[model samples]
Target: MIAKFLRDPFGLEDAFPPLKKWQLWLAALELEPPIFKTDVLSTVNDMAGMSGKDKETVRIMIEDAQEYSREDSRIDLLAAAMGIPPNQMDDLWKWAAQIEPI
Candidate 1:
């Protein structure tokens, strides 16, 4: 199931690209506490070309995660919602952490 989702995310026309848009949003959310708000707004602003619905979805996901008490639970819920495995979500989060401001 995980592999299948990784190969092709539902509603997306093609295979999940290595540089998924959600990855960028995830990265912004993971920024250091002091810079999180600025980083997220900056990142979202940089992705101004995305659809309004997509932007809303990303924002909601970030907010939901923020409400969680533990990062693991947040990641687990995110993985399930995104149809990816928890391990894959972990990898994506790590990847997000390494991303530099664009």
Candidate 2:
């Protein structure tokens, strides 16, 4: 662990991977007002200004993603639904990566 830390003092290597879906949700729920899963679902449902099929695809991605990548097209809508900008989603990803799942 010490060697790994010395190799990458800022954890940039570890932080680059996609963040697990659950981690992001966990963080969101821990927020002051608490962003419920329903909040994200409803917001995504309302904001996707596209065909039903497209919306469904996006919804599926959100519901089933194991890890969220910054390059994913759907991520823009996902982040926006959470009131987070696409570019800023990296911050979410970095923070989420640090969450230790139980």
Best by lDDT: 2
Tens digits of per-residue lDDT, candidate 1, 1-102, equal 778688777834332234334444555455443234444544654565767776666566565543322253434544444445766655655565455546
What TM-score would every model get versus the actual structure? 0.35, 0.74
Clashing pairs in 1: none
Candidate 2 lDDT, 1-102, residue by residue in tens: 999999999987755677788988887776666777787878767764678787788788878878877678777777777887655667667777789968
Q: Report residue 84 deviation for candidate 2 (angstroms).
A: 1.3
Candidate 2: where is the Cα deviation over 4 Å? 1-15
Model 2 residue 75 distance off true place after TM-score fit, in angstroms:
1.1
How far is 19's C-alpha from truth in model 1 (Å)? 16
Cα deviation of 101 in candidate 1 (Å)?
0.6
